[model samples]
Target: MDFSLSSEQREIQDLAYKFAKNEMIPVAHEYDEQGKFPTEIFKKAWELGLLNTCIPAEYGGSGFSAVDGVLICEALAYGCMGMNSSFMANDLALLPIVIGGNDAQKKKFLTPFTEEFKIASFCLTEPGNGSDAGGIKTTIKDGGDHWIINGEKMWITNAGYANLFVVYGTIDVNLKHKGISAIVVDPKSPGIEVGKKEDKMGHRASDTRGVRFNNVKVAKENMLGKPGEGWAIAMATLDHSRPLVASSALGGSQHALDLSIKYSKERNQFGVAIAKHQAVQFMIAEMGMKVACARLLVHKAAWMCDQGERNTEIASYAKAFASDSCMQITTDAVQIYGGYGYSREYPVEKLMRDAKLLQIYEGTSQIQRLVMARELLK
Candidate 1:
């Protein structure tokens, strides 16, 4: 099997890499320290058409395949995951519409993305429910031509500034997953409250906040897919998104590996470069190995999506394996840097912090395993 990127894919990858190195890397530390969103960088990415790569060309998007998007994600993530998340949040919010919305719905909800650099958020996890998506406590009530939604969503990326939210709520508690429905809600609607931004351990430059929907009303046309289809839509979106998440992890791991290697070669110890040390060499070797293997799995999953295959199981595998690998690789990178790695002055510490969230979000590593096991059994 061929394992090479096409000319177009290479072009996209190179573009993203240059942008990340020149724009993101320099300011990543500053943004992390200030805990501020990198709006200027995000705008640059948008202007380059990097922000909405997956939307179809007909809808004003570049219509890049899932594999193409993964390449871009990996490149950008190598520079800064916090900044990467701010840009990737646009994809996370819109994928559901791409997967489930009708023509008219797409026109109304997605066309705006083509016109301007607007942000949207995916609202799923609540204060109490994370891994147990079916147990979400948000509730929705039918009001003839409209629906009234009431709930609180936590850990919502881009919630602080999102113009729209793809919300999930239950129509009947007893029905569990079957009762869930997905709806698009304007963040400006009455009674919608965006809480304070979260103080996170990593990805601080990406906006994360609590959103409360208090009797927010939306037209029935805003519902994505049929009633009771939210669970499937959510799962499908995650399946498609897992590869992007894995690519982000892969990028961070690669960055960590690159930093460790450069530092080892330059830092002298006992009148010789540390690269000559066997122990340091082994660490770098392992780091390189992990990054390589994770990239294969990520690209494989993305390829499956582009091929119209049932990728749920492979997506879980890629997400779980790549994220777990990144965590280990980044940690080892810190270890290789010795005491300097632990210092905030060095970039490895932030890479370690950012690598952590990869294992937790999209789907926790444990949750990914559960999903894989279920798919295997079937």
Candidate 2:
């Protein structure tokens, strides 16, 4: 099997790498410290056509495959995961429409992303519902020509600045997953409230906020699919998205590893460089191994998606393994720096912080294992 990237893929990878190194790395620390969204950097990425890379060509997107998108994410994430997340949020919000929406819906909702740099959010998790997506308390009531939606969504990325939202709510609480439906809502719609931005542990530069919809009105034409299709749309979107998440984690792991290696060789102890010590050598070795393995898993899952394969199991495997690996690798990177690693002045500390949210969002590592188990059993 060929493992090499095609020339076009290599070009995309190189472009992303240069943009990350030249633009993102320099300002990442400042954004994190200020807890502000990197709007300028995001605009640059949008100008580069880095956002909405996966929308079909007919919609004016480049129509890059999942594998192509993964490559871009890994490179961009290596510079700053928070910034990468801000850019990637656009894809997460648009995928459901790409997967389920009709041509007219695509023209209305998806076309804007191609013509302009507009942000969109996917609203699913609530204050009480994260892993239990089917248990969301949001309600969608039929309102003749429109739907009235009422609910609170927590941990919504891009919510603070999003122009539109892809919201999921239920027609009846008792119907569980079957009651769920997907709809698009304009962020400026009446009764919509965007709460304060979250003070997160990592990805601080990526906008995360609470959104409350109080009897919000949504036109019937905004429905993604027929009633009861929200669950399927949500699950399918996650299956496709998990690999990109894994790629982001892989990028963080690689960045941390790079820092550790450079520092180990430059810093000296016992009258010699730390890289000479077997203990330090071993740590570096393990970090390298984990990054490699995680990349392979992420790529395999993305490849499966591009090939039109149902990748629920492999997607879980990639997300779980890559995120777990990233956490460990980043931690080890900090250890390699000793006291300096613990300091906020160094890049490794930031890498460690960024590595954390990868495990929690998209799907927690524990939730991924549960998904894998169910897929295996079935």
Candidate 3:
């Protein structure tokens, strides 16, 4: 099989890389240190069509394919995963709409962001449920022309910064998975509260918080797909996004390896550069090999989805393996730096901290395993 990127894909990746290097790299450390939300940079990125990309061209978006989206994600993430994730918050928010929203719903909600920089958030995880969608306790009740929603969402990215949210909750608990429903909520609506921002372990620049709906009213027309289709919509959304998450992890891993290799060559030990040491050389080699494999899987998964193929299994595998590689590579980069690695004076420690959320956010490594097992067993 051919493994080269098409000219269009290469252009997308190079443009994204240049944009990230020029814009995000300068502010990555400051944002991480201050845990500040880089709103201005986000707006700049939006102007470049870097945010909310999944929205179709008919809705004023650039109309990028899944492969293009993943390529952009990887390029941005290579500069800094935290910044890339903050920018990618738009994709997580809009993927469900692109995958399942009716034409009217898409036009109303997805079109506005393409005109200017605006962040959107996806609300799925609740206080009690992280990976289990069926455990969602949020409820939406029919109210004639509207629906009254009551529940809380935790660990939501871009919560405070997002103007729109794609929210999931239950309409009928007795129906279990079929009882779930997805709706779009205006973050500014009355009774819709954006909780305090989380002081996370990493990805500090990405605004994450709890969102509460206390009988918030949503137009019935904003319901995504049909009632009882929330679970399916959520799963389908992940089928598209897991590859991007894998790309994020792979980017962090690549940066870690690069940093380590450069340091190993320049730092001398026993009157010779540490690069001559067999152990350090072996570690760098393993990291490079894993990063390459993960990058390929990430691209393959996105390409499969763009081709309209069933890639549930491949997506899970890519995310699981790539995220694991991120964790491992960052850890090894720290080892290569020894004392300096564990300190804030060097970038590896920050990379290690940033790499961690990659495993937890989109789906835990264990959850990915479950997805893979289910698909394989079937």
User: What CA RMSD would you report for each candidate?
Assistant: 0.8, 0.7, 1.0
lDDT of each: 0.92, 0.93, 0.89
lDDT of 2: 0.93
Structural RMSD, model 3: 1.0
lDDT of 1 by residue, 1-378 (tens): 999999989999999999999999999999999999988888888889888776888888888999999999999999899989878888988999999999998888888898898998999999999999999889988988899999899999999889889999999889999999999999999989999999999999999999999999999999999988999999889988999999999999999999999999998998999999999999999988888888999999999999999898888889988889889988998998899999999999999999999999999999999998998898
Using Cα atoms with residue i matched to residue i, what is each candidate's TM-score against the true structure? 0.99, 0.99, 0.98
Per-residue CA lDDT of model 2 for 226-308, tens digit only, reads: 97899999998998899999999999999999999999999999999999999999999999999999988999999999999
Model 3, span 301-356: residue lDDT tens = 99999899988899998999999999999999999999999998788888899999
lDDT of 2 at 121: 92
Residue pairs with colliding backbones in model 3 are none
Ranking by lDDT: 2, 1, 3
List candidate 2 stretches off by more than 4 Å.
none
What ranking emerges by TM-score with the best candidate at the front? 2, 1, 3
